[model samples]
Target: MDARFLGIPELAEAPSVAVVIDVMRAYTVAAWAFAQGAEKIVLAESLDDALALKARHPDWVALKDGPPAPGFDAVNSPGLLRSVDLGGRTVVQKTTAGTVGALAVKEASLVLCAGFVVAEATARILRSRGCDSVTFVVTGEDGRADEDLACAQYIARRTTETTTDATGFLRRAGASRAATELTEGVRRGAHPDDVALCLELDRFRFAMVATLEDELMVLRPHDVPSPTGTAAA
Candidate 1:
C-alpha cells in the first residue's frame, strides 16, 4: 500500500482511493449527523444543487456552511446535530471546500469525506481494503498547513502506522489558522461546542464513504473492521 498526500487542486491526479478531509467543520458535521443516525448524506456541488435535491425529497434535511439558506434546515454545525434525530432521513450538505473537494475526484474507486472524528476509522478502512494507492486531499490547503492538512497527515500516518500518536500533528492543528478561527468563531457566537467537536479524535467508529449512486454523490457511514486490531486512541 502506498499513500500520497495531495491538495484539493490536484484531485484529478489521485489514485485508487482518496480521503478528502475538511476537519474544521464539514466532515465533522457529517460524522456528527451519522452519529445521530442519519441514513445517508449527499455532497452537492453547490447550494443550488443541494436545494434542488431537497426540493425533490422535501423531507430530506439540508445543511450548508455559514447561515442557513432559504431551503436549508440549518448550517453544518456538529453541535446542533446533538439535538436532532436524523434517523432514516437523507441529508443534503453543501460546503465551500469539503463537498467541492470530495466531488472533484471522479476516478478513485473509494472516496471518503473525513476529519479528526473519523480519522482512525478511515485509516482502518484503508488498511482493510489493502489499497495500492491512496491520497489524502487537503481540502482547505492554501500553502499553509491548516486543519484539513493536519487531518490528512494524521490519517495517512495512522493508515500505515497504527502506533503513531496524534499528539504532534494535533498540536500543529491547534495552532493552525483554521483552528484559531474556530475558537474565535465560538467566542463570536459560533456553536460553543463546535471547536471541541471538530477536534475530538476518532469520535466515531465509522467512516463516511462517498459513492456515486445513480447520479448523486452520496455519503454513507461504513464500518470496516480493523485490519490491525488497533484500538481507538
Candidate 2:
C-alpha cells in the first residue's frame, strides 16, 4: 500500500482514499456528536448551504465555527453537545478547515474524517479494505496547523506499520497555535472542556466515513472488527 501525507492545499486532487484530519477540533466534535446519538452529519461547504438545509429540515442542528447563529442550536463545540438532545437527529456542519477539506476531495474514491478519537479504527479499516493508495490530508487552521498534522502522522504511522514518537507528537500538538487558541477559549469560560476532549486519543472506537447521498456528504460511523473478535463500537 502507498500512503502519503498532504496538506489542505493538495485536497483538490487527492489520492484514491483520502483521510481528512482536524484535531483541534472539527472532527473531534463530529465524533462526539455521533456518540451522543446523532443519526448522521451532513457536511456543508458554506454557511449558506447549512442554513438552507436547516430551513428545510427545521429540526436538524446547524453548526458553524464561531458563535451559534440564530435558529441554530450550537457552534462547533463538543462540550456544547453534552447538554443537547440529538437522538436520531441530523446535524449540518460547516467549518473553516475540516468541512472545506472534505468538500475539496471530490475526486477521491473514498473520504473518511478522523481525529485522535477514531484514529485506530480508521487505520484498521483501511488495512482491512486493502486500499492500495491513500492520502492523509491535514486540514489545519491556515492550511498548516500542528495538531492536524500530528493526527494525520499518527494515523499514517498506525496504518503503515511504522514507528513514531507518540508522546512527542501529542506534546507538540498541545503546544501548537491552534491548540493554544482552543485552550484560550477554555480559559475564557467557553466550552471549558473542549480543549481537553480534542486532545484525547482513541476516545471513540468507530471510524466516521463520508458518503454521498442525494448529492450531500453525510458522515456515519463505520464499525470495524478488532483483533479480539469483536467490532469496535
Point out where model 1 deviates above 4 Å.
143-145, 186-189, 227-233
Candidate 1 lDDT (Cα, 0 to 1) = 0.82
Total clashing residue pairs per candidate? 0, 0
Which RMSD does model 1 reach against the true structure?
Answer: 2.5
Best by lDDT: 2
Please, what's the RMSD in Å of model 2? 2.0
lDDT of 2 by residue, 1-233 (tens): 78777777765565789998888778998999989889999999788899999999999988888776686667888788767778899999998889988877856788999998888888888878888888888888545788888888888788868454567668878898877777776322248788778878889999999988899999998888997869788
In candidate 2, which residue pairs clash? none
Q: Which candidate is the best by TM-score?
A: 2
Colliding pairs, model 1: none
Off by over 4 Å in 2: 162-165, 186-190
| TM-score of every model versus the real structure | 0.92, 0.93
What lDDT is reached at residue 156 by model 1?
86
